[model samples]
Target: MTADDRRVARYAAAAIALSVAEAALPSPLPGIKPGLANIIVLVVLARHGWRDAAWVSLLRVLAGSLAIGQFLAPGFFLALAGAVCSLAVLALAQALPVRWFGPVTASVLAAFAHIGGQILLARAWLVPHDGVFYLLPLFATAALVFGTINGLIAARLLALPQGKATS
Candidate 1:
């Protein structure tokens, strides 16, 4: 494989590992997750670019679902939708000035987009009722809290010495 391919694979592996680990945890809320794997995507976006970050994110969702035996399930679709929306938002956010809007802003926005996409998909396919919208506040709040934490972690990782393999 090419160097770039290897790097993407490594990043995706890391993300998948985190995803699997998160899956092992018992969440108090059904759809609420720490989304720690996203920190890898944010770091990849900052260091490599949006395309590489997208690869990492997509690969994580696919491989992670398979690893957790959730492929083609409702959880898989939710994850896929979230990744798509997160990547789209990250692409748009990349156009902003890096000086003012950096990894933290990108991470937070992407997190919200991810959750929003999942909610929409759930409402359309999983729940098929207006009642699903009632969970928006809880999901939104979780997104904000987890997104900020993930963003801070990504920003710190980005700020680390260049010797690390993340770049």
Candidate 2:
């Protein structure tokens, strides 16, 4: 396989792994996750570009769901929706000047979009009540906290020494 293909595979695997790992963690609320897999997506976005990032992100949702036995279920749809929304936000985020906008900004925006997508989906089909909106502040806070942390992690990875090995 080509180098980019290999890189995409590697990144996607890592993202899927993270997704599965996080799935085992206990969350006080349903549908609230740190989205740790997004760190890989941000890294791919920087090391490669948005397209590769999309592949990694989508693969994580698809493969991770299957691995967790949630494929084609409600959880799968929620994850797919979140990933799609986050990717759309990231696409537009790339247009911003790099000097001002970087991984952290992109992460925060994408995180918010991720949770926003989930909330909207939950409101529309799952819950179908205005009551779902009541959780906005909580989810938003989680997004901010997790997004910033994941972005910082990606930034650190981007700064690592290239002498380790060739891509």
Candidate 3:
């Protein structure tokens, strides 16, 4: 395969791997997910571009939802909303000076926006009960924690030589 083709394959593989990792994480909350795969997304965004990362994020959610048997459920909608919001954030971030903040900061903000959008969408379309409000703190905490970790991972990964990453 060509160099570009190899890079695309590697990126796609990382995205899928991360998605599976995220999906396998145990969740006590019904609507909350750890978003571990976002680490790979940030890496892809930094290394490749927002457009490529967007495609990876979208494919990860759709294929992941199907594999996890949530394709037909409202969770699919939540994932879609989160992915779109994340992509929008990444696109905007790309327009900004990279000197202001690193991948971790961007990842944190994107995570916050992602969860916020998903929650709003869910409340508006799927769950009308106010009980869902109780999960805000939990969701926020997860986003902060996971986003930080994902950002750190991305930062560390970006520091490594590209050839060393797959080793």
Candidate 4:
């Protein structure tokens, strides 16, 4: 495989591993995940680019879902939607000046977009009620807190010695 392909594969594997680990963690709410996998995506966006980040994110959702036996299920669709929305937002966020739009900002944007996407999908497929909106406050708070924490971790990893590969 090509170098970029290899990088994408490695990052995708790491992200999938994180997804599996987070899946094992207990959550008060069904959909509330720490999104540890996103840290790798953010780092890839920095070191690689949007395209590479997109590949890694998509692969993680697909492969991670299969690994967790969520493939082709509602949960898998939710994850796919979230990843697509997050990647779209991150692409736009990247247009902003890098001086201000770094890991944390990108991550926050991505997180909100991810949650928004999930809400939309859940409303359409799973819940089919306006009442689903009621959970936004709690989910958004989780998004903000977890997004910031993951962003901080990504920033630290990016700051490490170049010889040490986050991949």
Most accurate candidate by TM-score: 1
- Candidate 2 lDDT, 1-167, residue by residue in tens: 88888889988999999999999999999877889999999988987899999999999999999999999999899999999999999999999999887899999999999999999998999998999999999999999999999999988888887543325
Candidate 2 vs candidate 4: the TM-score winner is 4
Model 1 C-alpha lDDT versus the unseen true structure: 0.93
- The Cα RMSD of model 4 versus the native structure comes to 1.3
Candidate 4: tens digits of C-alpha lDDT, residues 3-116:
779879989999999999999999999889899999999999999899999999999999999999999999999999999999999999989998876799999889999999
Residue 138's lDDT within candidate 4 is 95
Residues 83-143, candidate 1: write the lDDT tens digits: 9999999999999998898778998899899999999999899999999889999999999
TM-score ranking of the models:
1, 4, 2, 3
Decide which is better by TM-score, 2 or 3: 2
Model 3, span 30-119: residue lDDT tens: 656667778878888888888778767887878778778889688888989988987888788787778988998879988988888888
Predicted candidate 2: what Cα RMSD to the true structure?
Answer: 1.3
* Candidate 1 accuracy as TM-score: 0.97
User: Runs in model 4 with CA error above 4 Å?
Assistant: 164-167
C-alpha lDDT (0 to 100) for residue 23 of candidate 1: 99
